[model samples]
Target: MTQLKAGDPAPNFSAKDEQGNTISLGDYKGKKLVVFFYPKASTPGCTVEACNLNDNFERFQSLGYEILGVSADSAKRQSNFKTKYGFQYPLLADEDKAVIEAFGVWGPKKFMGKEYDGIHRTTFVIDEKGVIENVITKVKTKDHTAQILAD
Candidate 1:
């Protein structure tokens, strides 16, 4: 897997949103994008991150940034999570792990003293010109939005 870094062009992809709409990187070509990859839907840490993003949705919008959350969860699960949390942004279903692999966020993880392969909680901030502006690899779930916005 090629690890992406700041100043690199973000790997482009098209994924289905919660509402089953096709959203592609090209669609947001001229806009700043916050594309976050998390392990699962509705989990404790994931929930905190998602909710924090939702709560600060407007602020991101005001800054002309679009938010997108991607996971290996099924479309149904993503839809349910978005509805339950009242999220204003799109939560994409990457069950095939294509986009995850493309972004190099799928890999081994350690949780509770056990090692396993899973999605890394990472966020990529793509600038308006489609270049990666910043990468938040060690994401703090609770203060995720603030951390990204501060970038």
Candidate 2:
């Protein structure tokens, strides 16, 4: 997979969120954004990352950042996860992998000696002008908010 880097132009994407609302990168035009990709919705690691972001949601907002979570799961599944966790941000259901591929986070992954293609947990911090300000490749799920705040 092609890894995105800081200062690179973030790939534009339009997809349905958990509520079936159409969300696009353009919607955050002239605003800071945190677009994170996870392997699946409602999974343990994904939950931790998302909840941490939610817990610190106000801090991020105060810093003028909007969070968006993305996964290649169905809209219904995304909705369930969001409701269950009370996430304040929208979760994009990129079932078609359109957004996932645009971010270039999909590729070969190995788990417990098993190999397969999957989404790489990545977080892209985009500036107001759509330039990537930071790319957190080595995410600390439990402390992701701190990481973003640090950057």
Candidate 3:
């Protein structure tokens, strides 16, 4: 996968959120946005990462950041995940992988010694003008907020 870096122009995307609302990059025009890509919905690692972000949701908002979770899951699955955890932010359902490929997070991955193509866990902090301020490829699932705040 082509890994995005800090200062790269965040690729534009328009996908449906868990609520079926169309969320586009342009919507966050004048605000910083946190776009997190996870491999799956309700998985162990994904759960921890998502909950950590949600637990600090208010703080992130206070810091002027709007969060959006993305995954190649169906809208129903995304909705279920969000509802189960009571996540405060919208989770994008990128079933078509359009957004995933745009962000360059989809590629070969190894798990338990088996190689396969999948989505990589990544987080992008986009500035008000839509430029990436930081791209966390080595994401700390439980302390992601700090990574963004550190920038």
Candidate number with greatest TM-score: 2
Clashing pairs in 3: none
lDDT of 2 by residue, 62-126 (tens): 99999999999999999999999999999999999999999999999999999999999999999
* Residue-wise C-alpha lDDT for candidate 1, range 56-110, written one tens digit per residue: 9999999999999999999999999999999999999998898999999988878
Tell me which of candidates 1 and 3 scores higher on TM-score: 3
lDDT of each: 0.92, 0.94, 0.93
Q: For residues 26-97, could you state the per-residue lDDT of candidate 3 as single tens digits?
A: 999999999999999999999999999999999999888999999999999999999999999999999999
What is the C-alpha local distance difference test score of candidate 1? 0.92
Among all windows of ten consecutive residues in candidate 2, which has the lowest summed lDDT? 1-10
Q: How does model 2 score by TM-score?
A: 0.98
Clashes of each: 0, 0, 0
Q: What is the C-alpha local distance difference test score of candidate 3?
A: 0.93
RMSD of each: 1.2, 0.8, 0.9
Model 1: residues >4 Å from true position, as ranges?
Answer: none
- TM-scores, all candidates, are 0.96, 0.98, 0.97
Give candidate 3's error at residue 80 in angstroms. 0.5
Q: Show the colliding residue pairs in model 1.
A: none
